[model samples]
Target chain A: MKRIKKLDTPPRFISWCAVGGYEEKNGPLGEAFDLCDESDTFGQKTWEMSEGEMGRCALNLALSKCSLSHETLELLVAGDLQNQCVASSVGLDSFGAPFLGIYGACSTCTEALLILSSMIESGAVTTGACVTTSHNSAAERQFRTPLEYGGQRSPSAQWTSTAAGSFVLTSDEELIKNAKLSNVAISDFMIGRIVDGATADGSNMGAAMSFAAAESIIEYFKESELKPRDFDYIVTGDLGKVGTSILRAILEERLPSAAGKHLDCGNLLYDAKRQDVHAGASGCGTSASVLASYFLPRLEEGEIRDILFLSTGALMSPSSVLQGNTIKGIAPVIHIHSSAD
Target chain B: MDIYTNEGKKEIIKKFTPKTKVLKNTLLAFIFGGLISLGAELLREAYIYFGMSEKDALTLVGVTLILLASLLTALGLFDRIARYAGAGTLVPITGFSNSVTSQALDAKSEGLILGVGAKIFTVAGPVILYGIASGVLYGIIYFIYLYIIR
Candidate 1:
């Protein structure tokens, strides 16, 4: 295999696990998740604490699945939608590995994976875990109004998934041999740029993020010298129904042939017609959980060979929104290949 | 085709923006607002039954509702109630109280005087200023109409 030298050598997945709350567990992809709690609060005191617990549970599940202890893990790279990524920090605090807290909003799952893979390729860490989480109550309270407030939701608004996904990566061949493996490897990645669509409305996240996803996908195709048909699926992170439509339209103009392969994690995360989620599911966990529960397993089973995982994020804070700053969108793409391919 | 252009970007974004559910929201507002008003009326009647005058009972009811709204906002319950109630929760005096209290709570992390104290009126500040101004203007007009005309 010819490796993209700039991106680094591909890192293989040792084990991955997805854990979700009640709403996500009841969704279409519910059966695919490794673990789920019936309660949104997960017996925690606050919604933030519940999110933290979900992250911790995902990491623990991933670690136990690989039969590796927390101390044996080289590093833990994780993030969440909460301010300061407190969910990840507090959730993974018990683990002995060095921690790197990152914030990419809803796209944090891919961002964490990209960083972990790069570290593995650099030979800096032989084994590392990437985790991302989001909670509905925590996100709602921070971004908009509290869930208790009877605020009318806009049709374009997405329900933040109360979920967490964790992936453990190992560069050591010996470790991979002993572990139950998915045989899915991260072959390459393209860091996305902040693309502003000149949108100032915080509620319209789909519009804010669609342009960035389209721009990044086009860039990935150009940089990899591959067409959209090259991958079995080109999955985007957290662009809901409306955002996906917007992205499809943009791609039709920019990369006309590639538009057909486009799929959005947000749109696919929930049953929109049955579920109250008007646009679709969003938040970092939306993409993370879907990948961990659905696509990663499909890759493992050789049902799919090559897939482009493009996670998009709206890099905006409540404070920034309050200050009238436009929401800047970002989308980072990672190429995942199954060993069978 | 170049979505990077201002016009193209705007056009595409507009297509994806979902419209507000005005009908459902209005219905919710009406129901919730009516319930809150009913509660206020009940409180006013209770105060009158306890030997308070009608005018004093009305004043007391308004203050009590404001206090209840502020308490609910602090407890983080008001927002959740407001979600389903929509303008129902917002159209009443309690809604105004919630706005002020919620902003103050949000800004509480910044510090006392600079944060909560300064930001407490962010949403309600304009309403208070305008409300007092209009009240004064109407009072002067009424005075002119009664005394000067007589």
Candidate 2:
């Protein structure tokens, strides 16, 4: 069966919002974020609770941006880096909508959107929401170490983003008119297969996840019969500096022309040298927040026409990493275009 | 597709991954670690000057170092120094204190019993287990040497 699916009458992303923490608020595209908490706490006593609050706030902002209520939300697809996806489930539980919790790790944003768009296209859901979040402290405690742990981070290690992103997608043109900004639509998507590059290092996640990104891009190019120049940019989720170069090299071998059009969410989120983020940023929020705040707005304003947004994720747990198992990478691409198309 | 294989990807990643500054890190670690040792020695000397025995002074110095490390970890300053210090902070007793204190602080949210009490030793557990185990093993070997070989 084909992994690429073209949505019939693409569902328009009517509203979206991005919420960020201290580091993210001071990032390069800091001002682009809709909401930010300087303390990174969001008034929550615990980091885990803070992460969940971010998801809740993001979804609320998204709904409010479109002037839509939770009742209108026919379906919700959400996930986060938390174990069993607790952040999204507990955070968004108050919405009381038909909810589906997914686990795509960092690829959650695109995966949620991909699933939501398919539901809308099938007329199974008229309105849906896609939300994902990640907090640096929470993720570090779960994946690597405690916040106060004094450990040297490798040069290839990436800082997890403490941010959240939410999007409201709808098939009804009437509701689309009520959206704060409505133009971009989900046109097509390709679900990536699990790929292991045999990288066992947890600190250097970009290396482990780059192969899956290459697979998605190469496969998309082959199936779509499109060149790099056809789209404004090809965005990858949290590949960082290391993974970006690796991806470019892999693309150069087969599709040399496609190498230069790449932009990694990890690279875009932080000023690596200035921020002292050795490699770059990674997490569900890294790509989700960037896309919600930066790319989608650009698409909506007609600044860019067509772009392929690829959300890449490394599918590995702490247990798996500790067991000397190789990290498995998965990336799913979403074809989002300006309504001008 | 063949080009995207694990072996091919590894070759590509090796070319792109940036090199770590081992020499620079080592130099920093050396300076920092040496400075920490010097401070401890001075503290031990100061304690001895106060009419304390050498053994008592040494014990007091150990307690002082542990208190300083724990305080820094609690104040959230140890990790910052440790970042650039590399193994400098880790090789010393300060590292062990920081590990235990940090773990305790992290799990403090889950409550004192199951949280801090249980998880306080998670990071330092291996070091402790192996340290004692190896010491016991060495003792057994020494006993055999004393009774038989000697």
Candidate 3:
């Protein structure tokens, strides 16, 4: 097949558990549209979900286990991985904390991290909550193939993990404050701008999304601002193996400054290590799982510190690239404080 | 209501002659169309009194009604009927059978393999499915009373 890579991410959270039950996504395009037309948000009505309505769904579940509320926080800055950034657009519902929306691709979580830390030190908000998620079937159905086409998947691709991931950005007081997080006073950090990353044909998403992972991470610490050794984990969303090695080499050469601190959610998920995926992770939920499931647990346990989390995204849209076009991409890097010990 | 003399009358006569929707099939359609339909309608009433199922009664009466239509179709009665009482000859069951069989006859010159052989089955697909479904449901009821009860 011709290498035609395109992506459109819907509002994403870190869990598969959130969307599947809302509607049974089945069938080909005409019928699926027919069913969803009467069903989920991707179903019947509007595309953008209010932050309180959606945020509370993900946060309320995580916070129920964490014991947090809206009053004790610093800032609630969230953005959707979807168009108009509506997925994370309405992040200002209940917590009353100042919120912001930024587009950095499926790499949105990292962008959200950059803002939370900025607010923490600038005295804007002591605590901050960062959230991002991508619905697999919803995102995929809207963007790529029909759900039932379960055709042969290329080794160059990674299975989009079904999960929603969220994190509490807070000071030392409470990790989750009223579902809003206190600022994690980062001892050392810098906001990294995307300069140069992978230029591989994203036709194989695993490769393309990973190229983004590699280039962004290398450009980040090299240009301004921080040492690679300053942080423990540098995670990228679903870069599987194809792009991970690509990311590793580019970083080791340019920013030999932080080679060992790299961690990629793409390659680490499952099949990314064995050159199994022709490309790497592509969806918003790809990193959503690792941030919420893998990284946050490690953060709470003090196993990692000075965390530098970045979700890599391929901003190639179907319309622009379909008619033979490519667009520039952006990745945001956030340096966070995990634990006091 | 308005009056017209020689020249105008000629144009009016030509217009009326071309557009007349006259049902002029005095034999194939008019007489048989009347008699067969009347017979089916009468038999339909008589059979219902004698306990004929609506489904079978519709089918039986339909065969007679469409027999009239197929004869009319064969004798070129339909082209004239197409002009008058527009769809009367088109509605009955025999009309559907007449459509397929007559088209087959018309295209028979194309050879049996391509025309007649292929034509009867052209309208077969949907009929096959509905036939199978109706037969299965009826068969199940027939079996329950005869085989199961025994």
**Model 1, docking class:** acceptable
Cα deviation in Å at residue A253, candidate 3?
3.8
Assess each prediction's global lDDT (C-alpha) against the native.
Answer: 0.85, 0.90, 0.50
State candidate 3's DockQ: 0.01
Question: Mind giving the per-residue lDDT tens digits that candidate 3 earns over A1-341?
Answer: 21111111111111111211121122111121111222334322322342224444555554444465656545665655466766654534555655676666676666675666556656566555676655544454345433322122434445453334455555433233333322233343334343322232334444444334554566555554456776787766655555566556556665665667777776554443442333444556456555655555456556776676667666766665556543334455555555436
lDDT of 1 by residue, A64-146 (tens): 98898998788899999999899998898989789999999888988899998889888999889999999998898778863
Candidate 2: the clashing residue pairs are: none
Candidate 2 CAPRI assessment class: medium
Residue-wise C-alpha lDDT for candidate 1, range B1-150, written one tens digit per residue? 557876777777776676777888888788889999999999999999999999999999999999999999888788778878888988789878888887777666568999778877877888899999999999999999999987
Pairwise lDDT winner, candidates 1 and 2: 2
Model 2 agreement with the true structure over B1-150: per-residue lDDT tens digits? 345566866776777788889999999999999999999999989988988999999988889988999999999999999999978988899999999999999999999999999899999999999999999999999999999999
Which segments of candidate 2 are over 4 A away from where they belong?
none
- By DockQ, the best candidate is 2
Query: Candidate 1, after superposition: displacement of residue A63 in Å?
Result: 0.3
What candidate 3 gets wrong by more than 4 Å, as runs, is: A1-55, A71-74, A89-99, A171-185, A192-202, A209-216, A219-231, A255-261, A271-280, A337-339, B1-150
Sort order, TM-score high to low? 2, 1, 3
Candidate 1 Cα misplacement greater than 4 A, ranges: A1-8, B27-53, B56-85, B97-150
- TM-score: the better of candidates 2 and 3: 2
lDDT of 2: 0.90
